[model samples]
Target: MTSQTEIRVLEISPPESLDSPEAELFHGGVDVEFAIAKQERGYTDLCPSAEEVLVSLRSQKYYKKIRLAAVAGLAGAPRREDVLGWASIDLPRHDNLHLAEVHVAVRPECRGRGVGTALYSAAEELARDAGRTTILAWSDHRDAPSTRGDDDSGLEAEAILRPPTGIGGVPPDDAPTRFAVRNGFQLEQVGRHSVLPAPIDSEHNSALLSAAEQRANVPETYQLVTWKNRCPDEWLEQFAKLRQKMSTDAPMAGLEIEEEDWDGARIRDEEDRTLAFGRTSYVTAALHVQSGLLAAFTAIETVARSTEFAFQGDTLVIKGHRGNKLGQLVKAVNLARVLTENPGLKRIHTWNAAGNSYMLRVNLDQGYRPEDVEGEWQKRLQESG
Candidate 1:
């Protein structure tokens, strides 16, 4: 063990200015870790492209709630040239405002040297200053990902291991998990991550579209409404309803996740956030003509810098409107739109709970494959005396 040095941690650039040396180092470190996380999980497609990373690094919207603190080497001299590591503290504004999510990453060579501890200290300080009562973190394990996407993948993985189980889960001595547990954090929940290959096979896609279309009434009882960025005012209210339903409809495996409490204003904020981040969201909704409301919806978000990666956002079908294959319908349509709009983006990544069989089935049918498993951890910051 090495002595703790005086490493300096500073908040990153103001939204208006992002061209300083420190800013670059912080963003570059985050970008590097993005790829590293994917490599660690051995996933073909589970991270933002380097280009996307830089683009987001410079975007105000992406960093709005995100507080980036970069740690510098404590050379004990005048110049601190090397960037040891960084911490990211996300303060959710509208919902879960009291919660602060954190991510602390240090250079591989810098581990066990107290760099991560310093970074977490910075993050917790930020969270506590923001009046956050609880801080949450996530740890992604390598062997936890499914080798293949099939009925047995989820079941077998759970049978084989439950993360943080202390038996076969991320060990107490593991790097990421160890860092948190050592700092008084407890395991919260785990989620299965997956990815969908882009530029879907022409033959398979056509058959899939045809299959979903056949589920809806051929007489056109349900119609499709789509948009590039913002939801149409006519459908805004109904869309909000679907979004709220999604917050609770999905399975939350023992996690303290609160409903998004969506509304038209929040919808607008989401759209604005997408624009601020220099990204585009291709959205599709199934409109129930008789009910005059949206029955189902899905979205595909793309960053300008990362033409090869697209994030598959929320996809939901209201309970009453379920079973019409709307999940498949909306997802299929949006995937097609993403492929057509951004041909270079060859992969669409998404995450789902292992128990979410219905959504998993729809995603599997749409060409998604297993990628990795992520576990959420939480630490109720004890009030400092």
Candidate 2:
């Protein structure tokens, strides 16, 4: 049994500096939540460190986001020990101004006691106040070994909720799925999370790269360019274009994300943030040697805490450049470079829309194995006249 009186939801103002007492307190709460979540989800590479969270809160270069936490303390800023759950409402400022992403997490022991509900309610109120029409949230689940339905198996077909894309499904009985359904949110899309064991045999990588190049049938004027940490001045403009295309061209299925605007300044900002988080990034671009412009690009970044893990960023082959295997070319080139550079990096994790067969095939060819499925849920708010 739970009541509104038991848990109080409060806004968490971004701290002035990470060294501040407030920062330490808030970080403690946030880190605990992440630890619990990682424990429940059984994924070590998915969660970010508390320092990363603080850095994002301090700077809103891309999204105007706010955090709310459910607490049980007296009338004041809640102490770290009093936090029962937290939620973040991320409002896109540039292109998708009407969309808000809400993420909620409650302590494992405090779940089912209204902590998550209180935090989500507070976050949703903020989004509503900002006039956001489409609210999106995500839930993570372990990947099912198979999505097949057998009449003799006892599990009914209706027990699994498959996205309209016809690629992935999630059990509706799970807590997260049930919560989303109960909150009037529909499971819009399912994305496959994959992990590629790293330090891939150098010989194997070379063979794949060779095969991709042969398949591309690219002109002798096409070449591969690699960089670390920062984009070169000469390629900044074209790199920005590739990123913008990635925003619009990527398979989104039924999600309501809009085309994002990216410029050289935004790219620089992102690079700085990645460095600030103590992570190193590797970038590979498939350049049209004739035009001196990037036609496709891919990025991989090392995890801050450990060298054994990294996350694959955007991999895009711009329009007019696809079907030539530019996607595989860049991905293979970048992976080979990163694996050789980070000897300790053991695995690289990535996600793709279930329906994105092109990129999925590219990833699978590079040895990426399915690790989990994530549901992107959305709810459209009615006009609040």
Candidate 3:
């Protein structure tokens, strides 16, 4: 039997030890009564599974700042013990500019007290200590407001009443939208998620190459080569430079996130992670030569397990003085190369912003079809606070 008393917040470091119970609880699903109890005691939301919690905790970005709450002294509670109810935030990687994403889980038993308020208070302190100026929280628009019919609903209601200062990604008709609106975050932009299926086998790839070659007007002076190793050092530099230029040049909404925002270290880290996950194969590069001058270049990585492998093109690019037809030629040759090497591949996946009609046309002509759209929701975090 537990007692109904004071709530306490504890900073649990390293997060790994909490995984088992967390996973068990999450998998078993929170009892509505337990959530209600927490809500009655003032807890707001539930934390995710221990595994996810651990990952967030262990990340170099947020480890030292993760905090949790133990609801103590609730009626019929386990003697001398409390249940974990909420998590605190301090994501250093985001710096002072980015607000921490707070996650809360209420034990059904402790709902309307002051557990959530306590947790949020601690989270705010943690953020301030970390030099953060804003708080970012999410909730579903369709879901009942945090305060709903509760005694302490006013506090819950106040947390989301301010305008959001910044927002990212598309808002589905789920928790995010509701949470933002209640908390004062305005919907900035609706975005979409896109996917490209795998590429076809070598036979189909060859046909695609032949067709593209027939249609493309790539100059004879340029030669398309597929390599099994890293691209030539100069080509690598050029590739990075061109990618930077293209990203800036591409039309999109909102602030332009600079190449510095996507530094080489981050790119290399991603590459390393991809290799560790076995998602990518050889890095492919295409160099356009004009009288021995490297006029244009492009690069791609082969994804073996991808659903897109069944298609004809993946990671296509054309850079520099290369004529418009060079894009098609490079894609065609690369597709042919990938097909010959991995005879079993079937489809290929790729993506372009909605505004990128030129690239879309090239892909369509090569037999790529429009798949589902991925939505990106944007919000002003400054206003929501």
Candidate 4:
């Protein structure tokens, strides 16, 4: 019901630097993200800074980035010159070329004005033109996180809807949920966002580390190796293999994603990108003593400016090494080192697919509590004949 004269959607290019004039819209988009997070989740801890967002847009060797913004100044004055919304379409370059990940965000005041729908329309058209057949998107849900530890405020079960995974649920009336369903995207999977308070008790950490090491048969058959920022030359290839496995080994549920293509070069590229974002990485991997191969690995990233929290990245135990508790072993060792080095860190945040019970259990055992739910939505586009 909106007219073209009210607003305009245009493709945007990343500014050369944060100080550039074109950067205003990009920074405005980041502000919108922070505002949305704070309004829904009561905090903006998960939102990245403008510098980080620009760094990601520039580092597109692995994924092609297309950004669009809706400007509300087409007519005369008043709300003129205001950025109403932002959208991004990411297309993988190496593997999963058939997929396009689309994200759209509108300013809180711009809701119900057709800004979001216009942005999405432009983004999806670009994806189709690029030959992408699968579109993927995610929505954040902060109300009534379905966890045993959290209370749902007497909400009825019938009002909640679970994805095909049958693990987590979101309220049917949530704005994001309704918009996605109206746009033909199916709820494919759900992920639980969790946080672990830091300054972990040294005694408790030691006890958990001992139990995990014993379960992993560490030192006897496997050894834990920890590093920061960069991987050692000797273990780069093995580490790259673990990174490759993370793509396929993780639960996909109904997503049409494929195994990612990774090499030592890609690993080094990612490390460089992390540094450019003003972040530091902490990694721990389990090395098989006899084979000298990395059987499992985990990583955590922290921003230099905010030493208050860290984000937990991928943690995976290769298929052959599943039952040995290597996941917990690497996570514990890496976390212990991170806490020691960054004494000011207050907490760590991580997300896992709702169906990934083993990893979820590992996180739970480490004292991570449920904070929110994320819905993974997917839609298949009709191929052009």
Reference-based lDDT, residue 336, model 4: 85
Best-matching candidate per TM-score: 4
Cα lDDT, model 2, residue 358: 94
Give the TM-scores of the predictions, in the order they appear.
0.82, 0.92, 0.52, 0.94
Total residue pair clashes for candidate 3 = 107
Give candidate 1 misplaced runs (Cα > 4 Å): 1-3, 21-25, 28-70, 74-81, 145-174, 218-220, 382-385
How far residue 81's Cα lies from its native spot in candidate 3, in Å, is 20
TM-score order, best first, reads 4, 2, 1, 3
User: Can you write out model 2's per-residue Cα lDDT over 1-385, one digit (the tens) per residue?
Assistant: 4456778877788777767878645764586667675777665566777778878887786899798877775477557777777888998877899899999987777778877877877887888899899899998777443322222234456867877776677778888998898888888888878888866777877788888788776558578888999999889988988888888788877788888899999999988999988899999988887777888889999876998899999998878777888888888888888887789988889998877889988888888888777888888877332
- Candidate 2 yields a Cα-based lDDT of 0.81
The true-structure Cα RMSD of candidate 4 reads 2.6
Query: Backbone clash tally for model 1?
Result: 0
Better of 1 and 3 by TM-score: 1
Clash counts per candidate, in order, are 0, 0, 107, 0
Tens-digit lDDT string for candidate 4 (1-385): 3454577887777888888777777776777788787777677788888888888998889999998888776643222137778899999999999999999998777788889899998999999999999999999887645644654445566777777767677888988999998888999998888999977777776777899889888798999888899999999988998898899889889999899998999999999999998999999999899987889999999897698989999999998889988888888888888888899989899999988999999998888988878899999997322
